[model samples]
Target: MLDQVKDAAREIADARRKIAAMGPNFDEEILGATRALYAPLIRKPSAAVKVTADVAYGSDPRQKLDVYQPAGAAEHVLVYIPGGGFVAGDKNLDGVFYVNLGNYFASHGILTIVANYRLAPAHAWPAGAQDVAGAVAWARANAKSFGGDPARIVLFGQSAGSTHAATYLFDPTFHPAGQAGVAAGILMSGPYLFQGELRPNLKAYFGDDPSRYAERSPLTHVGKSRTPLLLSVAEYDPAFLAAPTYELARAVTLRDGKSPSVAYFAGHNHVSTVMSFGTPQDDVGARVREFIASVG
Candidate 1:
């Protein structure tokens, strides 16, 4: 059963990559197809709400977030940000992503919040993070209204979203001027060094400021406070990028002053990690749920 599940998972992952490699013209179609794939698995579950609210405008005037929840859920909330190299993505297009995530947590009887923030190029580094932070504050203040547990909230993200999560986890200033911070966090396949010198793709969004890069890189901020975190990277995520992910994990270890638990999924690549959510017998999903449940 496990082998069969993994095999089917591989096929779905292949489709996910082909579409992503095709670029924007195919985004909606790919996302739509992915949603169809997940439809059967995503039971209506419990309570569900789709709420659109304003985030920070961030130089760009129009900035907003879409929040999703399960029916009658208690406050063990999760704030999920989508990854598109901090440049592209929308909550509307994230239906499949959030559906699987929301359903998974909802099945565990936990309230999950999937939010949209400003993206890059148009918005940039602190903009995306700031928008998410505002959403977090909103969640904290009204968690009870959504039937969620404010104190048990978790910040979770993948790829670029993982970057945002890591940034917020490390920088006490970014979360809020004086907020207590989240209980725990999960970063999937995120690069910790962001000084704009090493990574070309990120330079455009973060700019070429050594100080800004160092300050924003979570690795540089480790040990400030030990937030229980899980760092999971796909074993086959383009060989070139694997080292940075491990380095980021090591940073977490060094900063927390302990070896944080790291989960490596064999045969899984970068795009596949997010695709595995809510799939029965999916190893990565199981690990994520375990982490979220443990945190709760």
Candidate 2:
């Protein structure tokens, strides 16, 4: 057993070292290259939970969601939006990671919904927000059917999904469908404030004009949001992301009204932090659960 532990430790250390060596867009690059390799490695939880499959929220095929209901009645609802830099990502990618993530939460008595949204280049900013809103509406109206509370809904997103969810919460005009509400938000590893460094793909979502970048950023409106936020960054995250994360947090802190809860995940990079859900090393998940409990 000790030898197995040692071997696992060495593998994680090696992975981190390689990730650090691969600079710009390292998180996206590394994960893209290794999804097939990681797929077989993830083990689903032993807990039994009821699940409702592939429910549509929007006309787009991508805007579908899978809802998981806990064994018992759930009062707190979690809506998960994935990140793909506004270009790629699905609820079932790299061995159905999000499905397992949803199950883990459901097993713990949190009604969880794993949502999908339209990707950029084909569809842009407001489109993603609209899909998210549609999903929120579906959850709110149907929460009672799944034994979940409609009032305690949390919006959770990572990377580009963060941009969309944050926009929905911060921007005054992007109302969610059916007047559904978001009680709290979890923003992780998002490039909310950075300018002039967007990669080629980001143009699809943010647009071509460099001068208009600020208009696309949530930083400009994050302070306007009254909902409590938990903003986090990985310890080994790139400099660009690290800076904006703290910048956003500081901005929220300086706000006259409610402030954001902040955290930094030690020994993790942008990818690892989100990928750590349901594992023995579930520090990030614990943080998320604690944050949810505090608000829910």
Candidate 3:
């Protein structure tokens, strides 16, 4: 046991050292590379589905989304949003991730829309939120045209994307244009509170506005919710995320909101959770699929 412990510690330390060496520019480079590398993979979706890229979703800058359609008609659609701490991430880069996830849901007869929202520093809190809302609106509006059921739209996101998804569903100004509201949401490792100095990096985007945090926090907005919610948090993510997910789930439950559900994925970390989206039988994927089926 001691020997195994030592070996594991050494491996962790080595991985940390390599990560540290990657430096501040690593995320930017990785962001660019990941997208370019995955673009081709996205173009070739599974044979069971039809894939479309760069569909005009919103106007101008936010007007981009990738749509995945199953061979057969679908009664439900899931809009998938990716995560990158709200700093630097794009849907084009996440094409492969969404493709596989779409394939999974498509196999289960659900169309999927992978949306790209404006990132922060250039575009702040509500900008990305608005972009996501626009994409959802597009999906809902064109669901029938795409052979999907508009009444069964589901919002799915991970990490920062989860944060955006939660806020959009809960945010008063973010509801789909002229639509009643979404049916359900699946949030994985999302932060429910940003009023304080919880995350320094997040401050650049959310800012120090107490009112914004209060109004924007999903936990605070759950009372008026008209949709069922499934909040899943990885057990090993940062406390800033994990703790808030637990607290928000409790608060929503206490508020008598749609019997909100909660789950913690064991043996999974933050990055691993979202990256495991379409992987078969993985902890995060299994929980997400189960939640989707229940909500469907």
TM-score for each predicted model, relative to the true structure: 0.78, 0.88, 0.80
Which stretches of model 1 miss by more than 4 angstroms? 1-62, 177-180, 195-200
Give Cα-based local distance difference scores for all models: 0.66, 0.78, 0.70
**Whose lDDT is higher: candidate 2's or candidate 3's?**
2
Candidate 1 lDDT (Cα, 0 to 1): 0.66
- In terms of lDDT, the best-performing candidate is 2
Residue 52 of model 3 has an lDDT of 78
Q: Please, what are the lDDT tens digits per residue for candidate 1 over residues 1-296?
A: 99967776775566456545533332345545645555554334344544434444234443554445556666477878777767676544545655566566665666666667776566667776676677678778877777788998888887778887777877777775565367788888767676435555587568767777887666777666477888877655655446667887777666666788788876555655666566642677778778877885
Listed per model in order, the count of residue pairs whose N, CA or C atoms clash below 3 Å is 8, 0, 2
Clashing pairs for predicted structure model 2, backbone only: none
Task: Answer with 1 or 2, whichever has the higher TM-score.
Answer: 2
lDDT of 3 by residue, 1-296 (tens): 99966765564454334333433232456444433432332223467778777899866765588777888888778898888788866675433655566666676678888887888777777776787788888987898888988888889888788888888887667884544367798888878777756455587678767667787676777666667888887655667668878887777778783347888775455555554444432456667767777765
Error of 1 at 14 (Å): 9.2
Q: Which has the higher lDDT value, candidate number 1 or candidate number 3?
A: 3
Rank by TM-score, highest first: 2, 3, 1
Candidate 2 lDDT by residue in tens digits, 256-293: 44456888887777677767666555578889999888
**Top candidate (TM-score):** 2
